[model samples]
Target: MSEQQGRQRVDVTLSINGKSYTRHVEPRRLLADFIRHDVGMKATHIGCEHGVCGVCTVRIDGRTARSCLHFAVALQGHEIETVEGLSADGRLERLQQAFHEEHALQCGFCTPAVLLTAEEFLAENPSPSDSDIRAALSNNLCRCTGYTNIVKAIARASGREGEAASSGTGDAS
Candidate 1:
């Protein structure tokens, strides 16, 4: 660790989207900043720097967490997953495709975190009710599309294509 501007800086090595990144950062540097600035992965957006908003959500060791709430130094040697890693073969994941087809995203600020959250939710609950999908995404905040399309997209991705179609009337505005 070295001193920079009276704050201690340390070296951290972590994996993001299957790529290893080694960066020297301040002890107080949030993982969100580290991912965006140090690692050059801009898919992770920061909102409500206080962690209440889920825009900065990312997977730490396969579990969703608020990146803004964690320190970069504490994540040394940990595996991190961002939206950029969702499609390793240059094809959209099921959820991503559904989001596009269902029009789940508008403005797209919260789409990445929402997609990550819904991915984990659907993995754990493959056949979820509309209510269940809404519950799973309650933590994420989206100002566009009214969350109707987002739920439909998640439902569609979970293999409930008919149910997703029946629940919604038209595309979300």
Candidate 2:
């Protein structure tokens, strides 16, 4: 029975990326809006606001999903990971470096979300072919003509050796 200026405040707990977060939120707040505004994570961009653009993609539990498609209220006590959480020890992970080495970004607007989505896809299917990667990312839309490098980036991150060479997390390259 808590209240804010006008909206009721409900307790919400979420594990973002790898950290745990607990906060009070308005029921009507969209997850993307809440993440951007409250969490202060600028990486979660909103493009279509409609599920068309995967700019607001995040990982919930272990799967990639659109943050704009759900409400904060519905995500209470859920595990959510944004692009900001993709890094390890403040250093960009292997897939991220792969993006850089493979030149997977243009304009940089969609890179963060695309990175997270690619991470999820690769974690599930390490040996995904170009077409398989394409199918996995069918829901995401990138107009940068960077998908070629992006796909290569995923492939690079999929291998333990490549991941270590790029990620530097000691996975053994």
Candidate 3:
């Protein structure tokens, strides 16, 4: 524990996107806040904060987890991957390209989480059915474009776009 301005802080070294970030933070600081404020990455948005919205999703050790549900101090020495890390050099990843071509996002508030989730899901099940995709994305909520295009994007990324064509309501509901 380190003391700063009469406050006790914990120093944690987190590996994010293949880089190491060491910072002194309060013991109770959430990982989402630390990523957004300390590390200065804005892609990890905070939504419901209750682990229900899935807006703050990120890959912890190659598994998708809610950043808002974790504390920075508890994740010391852990591997964290955000949407910013999804791309290499200047080119977007295949899933991101699919999202772009499929017009999967609107308002763009929840796109990052959805992309991260879909990335992990596709890795685990490359040939997922439409219902499997929907079940995987059920935790993430979107207020626009229904879920038609988003599902299509994931399916396209998985080389199975044809299967998702008939699924989804395309309605906000």
Candidate 4:
């Protein structure tokens, strides 16, 4: 560890959004801060730094994790994906488009985490029921939209809206 700006700094090289970044960060620096301040990706929001809010969620080595709970040094060789990487082009991905169509966001603070969670969930399940979508989203707190539109958006994105409704799990009740 070397001293930088009065703190112990460690050299780390990590990939973010398909781009490689090498930086000297404090050992205690949160991954969220590293991504936001060091790597300059602002999509990963920091809320309830203790990892309860889930707003700082990102994909670490193909798994969803709370960036706020991990140190940048711990992710030295890891591959992280922020919301900006989800799009192949400069436009919104299907899930993001679904969110927009469903009006799933209000303040938009929780959108990134919610989108990441939905991406992971859909990747594993592909055709998740409404209950499954709700269960996956239960770990995150959203102060807006009441989760009704969010569920619908996920259902729409998964292409299971009718099945979810037929199963009586997508009513938002």
Computed on alpha carbons, the lDDT of every model, listed in order, comes to 0.85, 0.73, 0.85, 0.83
Sort all candidates by lDDT, best to worst: 3, 1, 4, 2
Of candidates 2 and 1, the better by TM-score = 1
Return the clash pairs for model 3, or none.
none
Per-candidate TM-scores read: 0.89, 0.79, 0.89, 0.87
Please give the range of 10 consecutive residues that has the lowest summed lDDT in model 3. Answer: 164-173
Of 1 and 4, the candidate ahead on TM-score is 1
The prediction achieving the highest lDDT against the true structure is 3
lDDT of 4: 0.83
Sequence-dependent TM-score of model 4: 0.87
Worst lDDT window (10 residues) for model 2? 164-173
- TM-score, cand. 2: 0.79
State the lDDT of candidate 2 residue by residue for 1-173, as single tens digits.
44555587787766676666667887777889888887788889999999888899988877788999998878766888887776756444777777787777788888878787777777678787666766776777788753666666777777632322243331101
Residue pairs in steric clash, candidate 1? none
Off by over 4 Å in 2: 1-11, 18-24, 89-92, 160-173
Report each candidate's C-alpha RMSD, comma-separated, in the order given: 3.3, 7.5, 3.1, 3.4
Residue 23 deviation, candidate 3, in Å? 1.5
Backbone clash total for model 4 is 0
